[model samples]
Target: MAAETSFANASRRPRPLTLVAIVLLHLAAIYGLARAFAPDAVASVEDSVLSTITVTVETKQFEPPPPPEPEPEPDAGEQGNEGRKAVPREVVAPEPRIVVKPAPPAPKASSTGAADTSGARDQGTGTGAGGTGTGTGSGNGGSGQGGGVATKPEWIGGRINNARDYPIPPGGRQARVGTEVVVKVTVGTDGRASDCSVFRPSPDAEADAITCRLVVQRLRFRPATDAAGNPVAAPFYWRQRWF
Candidate 1:
């Protein structure tokens, strides 16, 4: 009964050592919680974890793939006969033969004279003022054949006569005396100058242009004729000087 009493008393009153131990335990638990929640400790752990991770980005330099090699050309001899079929030969027509006709003879001229009126009958000959011929034509009775010859174009007025009335243009007045301009005039078969161009220009452009205009407008021509006496267009060259 006395031991029971003693145990009961101990149970009722807490021991100093036990109380101290309990208080120490509570303090240690609070310190541990504080350390766990500290910013510095969390930052340290994060830094350690981040420092261990390494991110590596590898870049590969890629050059464009080499251009494909060109295919070899086929041999000329081997491919020459490939995919070829026989073509029909075209029938060649014979060239036409050209026949040239001779020109007709020119008519003979007749003469008119007193002696040519004689009763003697001369067939192809004509007598002139006083000679031996069939007809009485002019000049000494020389039988003459008609002329069918080609002739060059002639200006209606002689070159000097045509240029006599040329007036100096207002623009050309400033140019020095004898400022020359050469021109080419194309004479048409109708005896008119159809086109003109300045072959050589003068100091004054207006003068050159006006010269061509006047040549084309005022100039007239006796058209050239071929051997058959057919009139043909021709070109005439002239030069004018400003005085």
Candidate 2:
């Protein structure tokens, strides 16, 4: 019975060395599992911490200094007449001078002679009366004669009648045959008519122009005369009947 009790106690109470070996084996298994998963856990923690963390930089700025104030100007009233002074001057008078002039001399008188009356008494009786009457008659005859008078311009009738055949104006034949055109002709000092203008115009402009041309070509005149009988240029007018 004692031996059986001893065997039972030995089974119930394990050996210290075996218990130590089991704890060593369990510790070794836990160390191997921690070694295998530590790298992945450390990598995952580093990724989360790096991804969630942020860094901010602050910058500082300096402000500019204020501007300087301008200096004030000087007052005008305080320095108005600081260095000015008045000076005195003297007045001088000029001396007067006198001048003299001579007077003109008077004219001298002339002498007169006496008259004789012995011949004057003899002529006053009868002989002087007949001589005075003959002198009066001669003076009256000289006063009656006068100077020559000046005359006006005169038209040459024969020359004007000869110039009746004037040129027929353009379209003049179609117009009424009895159209009278009057023109003023300026006669030069040489007795030729120049610068003729139509005094009376026809219905046709060409006829009026041609009439002036014909008058200047065909007409002639005796120029006017001055009071001294000098021939001068004058204007005269005449009429022509269109055929």
Residue 132 of model 1: what lDDT? 33
Error of 2 at 232 (Å): 0.8
What candidate 2 gets wrong by more than 4 Å, as runs, is: 1-152, 157-174
Candidate 1 backbone collisions, by pair: 111-135, 111-136, 111-137, 112-136, 112-137, 113-136, 125-134, 126-134, 126-135, 128-141
Cα RMSD, each candidate: 43.8, 56.7
Which candidate gets the maximum lDDT versus the true structure? 1
lDDT of 2 by residue, 1-243 (tens): 999999998899878998999999999887678668786775686679755533221111112243387587443221121222222222222332552543232112222312211112211232123224312132323444343324434456332222123333466343436565667777677777778887766666665676677657765667777667878776666665543
lDDT of 1 at 95: 40
Would you give me the overall lDDT of model 1?
0.56
State the lDDT of candidate 1 residue by residue for 25-97, as single tens digits.
9998977786778968867877797556432212111122445997984432211112222232233223447
Residue 108 error, candidate 2, Å: 40
Clashes of 2: 0
Q: lDDT per prediction?
A: 0.56, 0.52
